[model samples]
Target: PAAAADEPGTPQGPRAPLHGAAGRPAAPPAGAQPAAVTRTEIIDRAKTWVAAKVPYSMTAYWSDGYRQDCSGFVSMAWKLPANEWTGSLATVADRITKEELAPGDILLFHNASDPQEGSHVVIFGGWTDGTHTAYTAYEQTPPHTRRLDTPYAYWNNSAKYLPYRYKGVTAGKASTAGAGETVPEAAGPASHGVAGYPGRAMFGPGADNPYVTRLGRQLVRKGFGTHYTKGPGPRWGEADRRGVQAFQRAQGWRGGAADGHPGPETWRRLFS
Candidate 1:
């Protein structure tokens, strides 16, 4: 593939892979890890783990859990709660569901009081019959898989929820589940190039990275026009952040909320 070239005017340049920017084949995301064990199996095992260990507040740099907050449980289910950048369980719940939903989608429920009590979440691990079961890491509640239907409080209350479906879950791409389990559709990531810019430079400090281009793509989705161009730029800095912030403002994210600092909320909404 890399070695093959064009024959005369055969339009023979190396096209980037679909996974990369502008079809520019990107190296697979770095530091990526194989998902630990079969998800449901893990959840089933987690119940025993929760029973033995004491529940502590989540204190990872990415999470605000004094120990095992609702969002923290989801983060741990995906093994990335440490990837947190905000204190809002809403923010965490929003990000996980920002993608699509499958067997491993993380679910969240919130309250207004105790972290463990107010914010409760579960990791979707497929269904046992028509019932939904989840694996969660909590102290007050025993860790393990649970079915919230019959006696489990029948979840889905007024509290908002989001499910994060990890890529490459079923097959190499994505798949749809049958019946009972509710599957979410994808919000198209900016797969094609936008007006003006069309290279791997849109994600730089001023412009660079597929993730940054994603930011611009989000602006476009929210009904904003690109003031500049497209493609991955150089680095993600001021001008970039400003562009993002401006887009957020246009989206009516106010009250110092969407400050363009570019954290989880920004990515969740943008990537959503």
Candidate 2:
């Protein structure tokens, strides 16, 4: 699993179940198409991802064959010809202030000196509180699509979030910025961001969390498991552990390392 700005660090080892949402939110309604998507459509597309509960992939994983990273997800929402990293994407937008943020605007986190190492972007879904300390947002993160409230990594520090709006996105005028251009469907992950799963602190056996469920889905997707006849829930059971070990074995890991417990190295490979 590649590290994204949303994640804090790797889990030391498997542990007891933690309390929280499964790091995923349900998708918004597909709704009726308007012949084409509008700026509102861009935001709606992002919401749809939340409803679908698409899993995150540091290698810029694709869901329904569309790239799914913070930037890639934004690109998909903006309907760009190709996926673009946050830096390049920022080039096309006009910088704005926090007070100017609105639906469809982007919240960016980038260090101009080293954009690739620690950068993230999210779609503004509006403020959640009166003081605006927290807000609703749409983002692609490790584990899956998120409909999140603020106090998140990229949003905590006012200095971290640089607000921006696409040039074509006007406040009172209709625009085609979200209509997007067509490009060849490409393979491979985006070249920006850390290359590993950086969602939770750790994923241990018997740990029923969204991270575990995410791992289970990835394992099944990669042909490592058939343990779940129904669906992979947020639980680290024998089947989930077995799938991890299988993936390790397939990667040629030896002895204890392949014993089914995921370490940083294992996560890197799994996410990559």
Candidate 3:
């Protein structure tokens, strides 16, 4: 028999049954309407597994009752009315462009001819830099759930991974600023003591400057400090990237706008 579509590697022995809320099968009810969700909520749901370090298994289910695999991770994150697999996921989502990629969207590579080979799906967290050559990917693979800085599309099968957006997603109340738009001056207390946004060159890989420190401190002040394990120092690190990404997502920014590298708009809102 072919391997499960979501399992990329050779199948392992069945995992010990999960011990928590009773296990539920990974099947959605007939005719269920997926609840409306926001981009922020989807990313938040995806992080729950990362926090719990949920193990991956095609046959197992998590306490919250989703299958413990790549597709199931996405089903839970999208808050779909029921579980979905690689084949069925697209029925509920629309194919999107790479430029349209945003937090909560997915980069899916499903193999219909052979379900196992390298078929998989990952939640698009945000871009790691302006180049769009890499991004933050949240996935459930062997060992556990992980948030990684992945190459465009994926490390393997780069050409096959296509971007998708869930049809039921709705933009939340926060205002979004697109790329190249002039970021208005912050209107409230957030503007106080906030320095102007330095050029983009001040941050990203190999950037070591006081502005990086300032950005890190402001991120911590704005409740995104958890990404930092130690100093929000002058040097840029994964923590800084993740912290900035979280702040950008909070503002309803997506795609290039939320690339973790702070643009002028991201700066205005973070300080605001």
Candidate 4:
């Protein structure tokens, strides 16, 4: 029953990074672009980063830039298509559905009821071997660099990176049509394309088995969420599940229930 979800003193898990091993936020690889980064590539980079450190918020470490919050992180990670990219969590980037997620998918963690409420962002590294990790903007994460690892080891509150990671996909191959295929056209001076086309992250398209940590972070934030709240182990569980379900119901999800997996139908509603 939903009431059971509200149980206090529920066990949680560790904070997960949505990006990569927080090792040393390396400079973007030479000529790193979408064409070179397949969806699989995105996940690979994230895994490397996570095993190192954890992704942090630009606001927390560095402030005043194009992206400042969770969604902003997504913009930076996937690197938007252009400075004119039209989307935020409330706009373009916010259209993710659970099941549609893959590695490098950005998950926007925000207050469920407050439309203007700010949120955190985590890149999905979908499930792998019954465990998952993420790149996160955790407060303790290093300043101004993509951190890696940050394991979730749970199955709740995970968010997905939308449209961004899916930039140039053709069946399974990374699309190399336009140079602006993978990342945004406004990352740095002389924005370049990957290989032949502009590509995105190396994390795989529809990448599974490695992006669940972001989902776990989502659960931790809003699950038993409250002002200045903390949980056990950072793994989102009963409390987090309840919060996620409530958001889904408000979004008009059918038969809103927390069953762990964010399926396509679940995403359809969230995207709507």
lDDT of 2 by residue, 1-272 (tens): 13333464211111111112343233223331212334445665686688678766545445433455677777667655445566666765779887767667788886567655557788886654346566667888667788766553254344787888766553231221111211122211221232544322224321445777777888888888776665777755557667888888888766555656565456666777
Best by lDDT: 3
Name the 10 consecutive residues with the lowest summed lDDT in model 4. Answer: 7-16
Q: Please identify model 2 stretches exceeding 4 Å from their true place.
A: 1-6, 9-37, 60-65, 152-158, 170-272
Residue-level lDDT of model 4, residues 226-258, one tens digit each, is: 311443323323333354455555555444143
Q: Higher lDDT: candidate 1 or 3? A: 3
Q: In model 1, which runs have C-alpha deviations exceeding 4 angstroms? A: 1-48, 51-53, 56-67, 81-101, 110-117, 131-159, 167-272
Candidate 4 structure lDDT = 0.35
Among all candidates shown, the one with the greatest TM-score: 3
How high is the lDDT of residue 82 in model 2?
A: 46
Computed on alpha carbons, the lDDT of every model, listed in order, comes to 0.37, 0.57, 0.73, 0.35
| Better lDDT candidate (2, 4) | 2
Residue-level lDDT tens digits of model 3 in 1-272: 13322334623222122234654444445566667886756776787799799999887778886778888888889987566778778888999999888778999888878767677889998776667898888998987898877788887788999999999888651122223343233322232233576555456544567999999999989999898888688877688878988888888877656657676667878877
Q: Could you arrange the candidates by TM-score from highest to lowest?
A: 3, 2, 4, 1
- Model 3's alpha-carbon lDDT is 0.73
lDDT of 1 by residue, 163-212 (tens): 54543233221111111111123212332222322222222221234666
lDDT of candidate 1?
Answer: 0.37
Cα deviation of 114 in candidate 3 (Å)?
0.9
Number of residue pairs clashing in candidate 4, backbone atoms closer than 3 angstroms, sequence gap of 3 or more or interchain = 80
